[model samples]
Target: MDVLSLIGIILAFVAILGGNYLEGGHVGALLNGPAALIVLGGTLAAAFVQAPMSVFKRALSIISWIFFPPKVDLIGGINRVIGWSMTARKEGLLGLEAVADSEPDPYARKGLQLLVDGAEPEAIRSILEVDLYTQEGRDISAAKVFESMGGYAPTIGIIGAVMGLIHVMGNLADPSMLGSGIAVAFVATIYGVAFANLLLLPIANKLKAVVLRQSRYREMVLEGILSIAEGENPRSIELKLQGFMG
Candidate 1:
């Protein structure tokens, strides 16, 4: 689980609640169910209209990534790649076949297979680079999905507020309920702004960060494959890949 994401959201809510309590404000004032339905439901409906069905589904998946990020053990992967390269050098390209067989990651396995099959260094780089670009594009699309939601939320909030105000105005003749009607009307705006700023945008940024980190690993894999193809020393390849991390 991503502790930072959890902590960030918790702290945001806690700070707001704490400030409200300190000001002697009753929590019940912020607990209007109708307001939440207006803001949240309206925003979701607007988002469905703004984004394609595929993009909407992708956004939902990316939101989960905030709590459970992709796990990539870079150091371990690098060590294994270096070890295989050394063995290939000492025992010939065929030696890498064994390493490839034992490897679990399809990316690394594919790289080793190319190396063992006598693929040119440039060809290996091109293949891996294309794959890297494809993966990056997918990640970017996922981030854009949330970004679209962020774009829609604020406008939806405005729509909700307008609807609430219209309803309030219709009931203006009821002097006893005028104050409560106005309060409920403003709650929709509050919900819209809060959800957009606190949840959607932050999740988009977090997904971008994860994509960048994964891109770094792909870069390392590219360098390792190219170095091994060129018959460079395995230690030299390790150092080259390490530079990317730092």
Candidate 2:
């Protein structure tokens, strides 16, 4: 579980609620269902119009990453690859073929396949680097989709508030309803600002962090594969990769 995400969200809401309580403001006034629907629904509609279906799907899948990030196990995966490379060096390229078959990660599997095929060091590096670039670009694009939504949501909220004010203006004859109408209208703007600042933007930042960390792992893998291909000592390759980490 991503304790930091959970704690951050909890703390943000708690601070708001606590501040309201200390100010003698009733929390019930903030619970306007229609305002929430307008803000959330309008924001999502705008997102759908701007983002691709694949990006939308990826965003949804990654939303849970805000609360429960998947483990990457980077050090362990690199250690395994380094071990295999050492064994292959001691035995032969053919010896690493069996290790590759048992590998789970597609990236590592592809690297091993190239090694088994007797691809040169430069060619192996080129293949892995290309795949790394492609994956990094996709990750960045996915995050940017959410970031764009964060940028759009506040404007949608303002629109909702204006619509609410129009309805309120139409009912000015009932002075008692004026305050509620204005409060509800402004609620849309609040929702928009809160959601954008608290959720969408944060999610984009988290995904960017995840992508950078994953890229680091990919770099380590590239170094290991290239070193193995060039017949460098496994210990030397491990040290070289560790240098990148530190």
Candidate 3:
């Protein structure tokens, strides 16, 4: 679990609410249904229009990564690569067939299968690089979905504010309606800006970071598999793969 992300979320709310309290503003003042509906609904509608169904689904699927990221155990991965290297050296590439059959990660399994099939080093590199970059591109695109939402949210908020002001202008004769109109106007702006900065954009960036980390781990696996296919010494493979850690 990401304790920092959890803390950040709590802190963001506390800071905003605490600051509001200090300024003699009650929580109820910020709670405007129309403003929230306008900002959140319009922002989501814009995001839906911008992203394809596949990418939108991908974004939703990976959203949990902000709090529960996929594991990237570099040390353990390096050890597995070394073990594969030792196996290949002991009994040739064919020996990896059994290991490949039982490998859990699809990316690593594909590489192992290629090595076991006696694929050339260049072929292995080409195949795995395609897989690596393709996946990275997809995940990066998914992360950008949140980025697009962030971009739209603030503008939608402004629209809400303008709409509220228009309503205020229309009801100038009614003094009773003025307070609610103005509240919605300002609160809509706050909601839009706060959601973009504190949530959407941060989620986008964090997902991107997670995607890159996964790509790096896959890259390490690819390099290690290629080294084994080329008959590199286990020690040299270990040393080379360690470079990825930094």
Candidate 4:
């Protein structure tokens, strides 16, 4: 679990509530469920229309990343790759067959298998880069689902606000209720903008960052694997791949 993601979200809400409290506002003022329903439901509807069902579903599934981000251990990965390089040097490429079969990451496994099978470095690079980009595309697609929702949410919120205003307009004779009515009407807009800026867009960008790091790690593995296949020194391979660590 990534504490930063979870902590950051909690902190954001805490700040929101804390600020609200300091401003002489009650918590109940922000608890307009109807406003939330309008903003969220309309945002979802808009996102559904913007993307295919599969993409939308996939996007929702990955939302847990906001709390439980997927992690990569670059230092450990480099060590693993260096171990494989050492194995290749000591026992030749065929020695990697067992390790390749045990490799957990499919991309790493495939690249290792190719190296063990004496595939050309150019061919390995081509195939691995394609595979990396393909997975990157899928990750980005998932992120875009949230991006679309974030994009639509504010507009949907405004529409909800307008709808609420129209209702308020219909009841304009009740002067005593005017203040509360206006306040309620604007809740949808608040929900929309807050959700967009605080959660959806941030999560989308986080997913993009995750995908970028994944791509970098995979590319490093590809480079290391190719170097190992070429009988390069393990130290040299480590040096080349370590450039991607940060």
Candidate that would win on lDDT: 3
Q: Tell me the TM-score of each prediction against the true structure.
A: 0.91, 0.93, 0.98, 0.94
Count: clashes, candidate 1 = 0
Best by TM-score: 3
Regions of candidate 2 where Cα sits further than 4 Å from its true position: none
Point out the higher-scoring one by lDDT: 1 or 3: 3
Clashes of each: 0, 0, 0, 0
Among all windows of 10 consecutive residues in model 4, the one with the lowest summed lDDT is 176-185
Error at 29, model 2, angstroms = 0.7
Which is the winner by TM-score between candidate 1 and candidate 4?
4
Query: Candidate 4 lDDT, tens digit per residue, 135-243?
Result: 8898899899998889999999999888888878988998876766677578988899999999999999988888788888888888888898778999999889889
Off by over 4 Å in 3: none
lDDT agreement with native, every candidate: 0.81, 0.84, 0.95, 0.88
Q: Which is superior by lDDT, 2 or 4?
A: 4
**Tens-digit per-residue lDDT, 127-225, candidate 1:** 988888888887778787677677777777777677777877888888777766777667767777778888888988999988888888878877887
lDDT of 2 at 206: 92
Whole-model lDDT for model 3 versus the true structure? Answer: 0.95
Give per-residue CA lDDT, model 2, range 1-246, as digits (tens): 888988988898888778889999878877888788888888788888888898778777777766776677777866886897788878898888888898888898899889999999889998999999998887778888789889988988898899889879998999987876788788889888888998789889998888888888888888888888888887887778776656
Q: For residues 1-246, could you state the per-residue lDDT of candidate 3 as single tens digits?
A: 988899999999999999999999899999999999999999999999999999999999999999999999999999999999999999989999999999999999999999888889999999999999999999999999999999999999999999999989989999999888988899999999999999999999999999999999999999999889878999999999999999
- Candidate scoring better on lDDT of 2 and 3: 3
Candidate 3 C-alpha error for residue 47, in Å? 0.5
State in Å the error of residue 1, model 2: 1.3
Error of 1 at 113 (Å): 1.5
